[model samples]
Target: MLKLKSPQKATMQITRWVSDLDWRLLLLIIPSLSVLVFLSLSSTPIDSFPSLRSFIFNHTLLTSNSPDFVNSLPSGVHNRRESSVAKWKDELLRSRMAVCLVGGARRFELTGPSIVENILQVYPNADLFLHSPMDRNAYKFSLLKMAPRLASVRIFNPKPLNETESQVRVLTAANSPNGIQGLLQYFNLVEGCLQMIETYQKRKNFTYDWIIRTRVDGYWNAPLGPENFIPGQYLVPPGSDYGGLNDRLGIGDLNTSKVALARLSLIPKLDSAGFHQLNSETSFKAQLTTQHVPYLTKRVPFCIVTDRRYGFPPSRFGVPVAALSSPGPLSGAKCRPCTAACQGRCVAGVMRSLYKGWSWTDWDNGSLELCNARDQWERGWEKIFDKVAGKKSASVRKKFADLKKKECVDDFNEMKKRVSNWEAPPPEELCGLGLAV
Candidate 1:
């Protein structure tokens, strides 16, 4: 039998040999040997080669034995599956529809222009249903000619009735069947909206993917971005959640519409569910919660312009007086066109004092101002309007030219850009109380 050298002696001999060899040649030979050994080891089958199998098995044990491996793998799988499900649901819900219900006096005059110019124009794909107690003045909204489809415009001649009488009239007529008197009045409005969807769907042979419900007199301050649509959730403005969802804005799949439009009827379900004396907002919130419906709130860009007035130092019991000159296309809530007594620092202070949880968001850091335009429209409001209009209107074009000749072009342009980009400082910024974005 040939005698093999001991391990230590063998290693010493190899080291001495390497030390004597050309360094470059030794480096090349070492890497080449490493590659050959790796291939030979890898090619050996597990069962046939005990040493190689042991090496691989030890590596496998090291990796699989890690506590994090078991913990993380399941979590990764779950997240991936959840992501896939959400993607599928979003795609399925993309074809939904929206319904805008417009009722009340001066619906056209106060809100029609802005709706036509901003919302309806931008969202041409949306269906518009007008249910107003008609007045001859409704004719003034020829601009609404652009609506993709207009559902029935019911013109009920509302007799001057007290609050109780009006409520009863509205409720009874909304419930009536054929004579357009009771529940039918409300049903007509709801059905008219549904019919618009049905007509469009039948014409296209498809169902709408989503529906949005909003009031006619609600003026929009910003573009309604598509990001507002959340799957499996109805969305409304935050402050207006009045207990249920804000009856003002509702966005959901067809499944939600069936429950939401049964407004008067839902009251019984609410009362049956142990709800009592619920106000409009609260009742709306109850309907969703009781039905196990999910909902979300976003800051919708609108203001319900009201005409009610309250004294300064607004009594803890004082009603909030919103300015009509409130940089809005004023949808008819109620508004007074008077100069904001609460300007500059005072405006910032009042906005800060507002109950954020109940009223408005951080008031954009107090930059919001109420232009009480009831007593008088502000002096420079026309100029401000002209600046914002830019080349959109011929009148604005003329105004811009006159201002340019007066050497106010730079200042005007700066202000116009700020408004255009919505970069105006929040009320807090103007007051130097907080950082402005």
Candidate 2:
């Protein structure tokens, strides 16, 4: 047992030990190297990486889903994203697109110019469609004159929709501000935009490759980036899913868009399937599911800017209102400007308290801020708005806030000159109703 080894024998023994160490290292490092290589090669289109994409896009919770990982990517992944986005933009440039805006112009004075600059101008080739109901504040829509293009504009006073038996059975009156009647009116506006697009295609003997349906009250903080144009998927903003997908904004190719925009026409189909008591969001999910449309969710760069009051530290069933300045796409969350009533750990506590399946939004990584909306928007909401929106947008807001009947009429006239397929009541009537003496 105490025998000493010869020099050559000891050397051979040491070489064997070194060889064993190398094998162990290879066993440990091989897997990690494979993973690194796989990730690096995943620079193809989204369709190329179905397994990884499928992982991010969960099966339950209303179809497929994915988050915008734009901010958190490593430098290589970030560059890859830019390359992917460039490809999307290239496809868009070679296609026809329609950008539809629906609903009332409640806060349009503040929201309109941003739409013109951020969306309409950004996709200057995409035709614009405006379908809004006439209201006392309708004069504010005159701001859309700055739009790069217009396919159609219909600002009409809505007659009450006769809620069919199917509508009554399927759609509940709860949570709707104006009840089932209100839902119908909103649905009509959404569907009406599709109808208008169809009519335009018929008139011009052409078809659109893409349809982007958004709201009139939505404010855009940045451009609707090219990355969202998934060929086979309907893209809706993430969060604010009130027992349904966010209906606030939708983007899709022509085939998927039809299934989405057919809000009213699909109700009969929903009723046939024995679905009832559905809210707008739930009904939206049902429509797409039944139609076999695949959908994707990404953080869109817009918010439904609202003046409606909501409670702070939103209760289990209550709505969480975001501050306009919250560095969010806000993703269709109702937002208003005020000193944040909640943020940081406060946001964490409040978000935890909310029903995640209900009116919850993404509040991670300090991307969200809250507004105390129990009362009216703060007394100096203008100053707060101007500060958040910066000088260029604030000047546009001031222009509309100071809009007179004469100036409003002038703007409409200018729009009439530029807009193709303009379909609406006269400028005088539109201005007259909103600015009556």
Candidate 3:
């Protein structure tokens, strides 16, 4: 360097000085170089220039947007995720239903068997709530093993409770403004069903899809098909409307159920809503109409084999005519060839009395008749269950006995076939000789 060095030698000497720098100093220099490179790349906006800061910022923003990242961000973010997930789960599980079974426990041996066999058996997924005031024979009736799913409350024994007991048991008031016994009992039945819904919701963390309220004493003359489950509406029997909805068989979503269940409270609402002189059936109708709940009526394959008696030519407002001798694989609403004791022209007229805007011409006259079963039952109906139940042959008798024990009448295989074919047995076969009332 003292002598005038060449340009190449001077360049080599500068390089050597850089190479001789300490490792720690070099490490510090590397970061300084990186920063310079980053700044240069960022400032120079070329079409192909890769900017480290821009790339890093974009990746960081994307990570922040991700659920996993959001969940991990902080305590606040994690809590938010948990809350959102919980809400979603609750919404997913929310459903509407409240099954209610009412009336006296008369004919429970026959009716109970049919319910467990046909209706309840097929709807294993359903909630089965019962409200019959049990009689002395209640203990004799075969309680279905599956009943616990719907009846956590004690089976209603129709005994009069003391004032304190009544007060404790009374959950809702009757829809009747006057609070008649029938209406009060009905209210209690509905209340029990509501309690069931609440208990089920709490225990299982799920709600119902629909509540099917029917009588325990009803004998299913046929299967309870899935077609009955109408969307956003309640369903009931056709001929029993009586200017109101049939409370006997109610298929309702939760909203309808809520209005239907609020017995005493519902009356004031109905009154405020401008309704008057509502009977049980009419009140049911008012409840639906006032709450804007829609309903449908279909023939279910069953009848309320009543204890009452009426003449062949029924009074103008007489009891319904049902066939004593029916060979029914009856579609719940098919009343073909039916004769009426009421003042109506045909079964359609009977149905119209109960349900407005009902078209009953579709009823099958040949398939059904309205005969009084109470008289027959009182005479020798014990033989009827034995005969139809096929008590003769070992295999047939065994099957019948099995059905009796299980309380399930619609054999799954037979049900499947009927559903597939949509072919019901002829009324003649259902009503003739051995099948007759």
Task: Indicate which candidate wins on lDDT.
Answer: 2
Using lDDT as the yardstick, the better of models 1 and 2 is 2
C-alpha local distance difference test of each model: 0.46, 0.80, 0.49
lDDT tens digits, residue span 105-144, model 3: 5555556666766666565555555544544333323334
| lDDT by residue for model 2 (1-437), tens | 21213322332343354345543364465465446435544444544443333222222112212343344445675675567557757778778999999988888888887888888888889999999888877888888878887788888877988879999999999989989998898899999999999999999999999999999989888888776776667889878888789999999889899999999999999999999999999999999999988787888778888778877668998899998889887888998878888989999999999998788888888989998889998889899889988898899888776677898899999988887677677888888887753
RMSD of each: 22.4, 11.6, 25.9
Candidate 2 vs candidate 3: which has greater lDDT?
2
Worst 10 residues of 1 by lDDT: 428-437
Candidate 1, residues 1-437, lDDT tens digits: the string is 21223322332344566557653465467665445445544534454343332223222222223345435446664465446445644553344455555454343334444455555655565555554444433332333444554433333444443323333432322212322243334434554555555555676676666677766656555555454555455667765332234556776666666565555555556656676544455656777787766565655555554433345544333224445435432222233334455555766666556544333322343434554433444565445534433334334234323332123323323333332122222222221221111
Clashes of each: 49, 1, 31
Assess candidate 1 and give its TM-score to the true structure: 0.54
Ranking by TM-score: 2, 3, 1
- Which ranges of candidate 2 are over 4 A from the true structure? 1-80
User: Which candidate leads the pack in TM-score?
Assistant: 2
In candidate 3 the C-alpha lDDT for residue 196 amounts to 61
Give the CA lDDT, 0 to 100, for residue 143 in model 1: 30
TM-scores of all candidate predictions against the true structure: 0.54, 0.84, 0.55
- In model 3, the Cα lDDT at residue 208 comes to 69
Task: Supply candidate 3's per-residue lDDT for 112.
Answer: 66
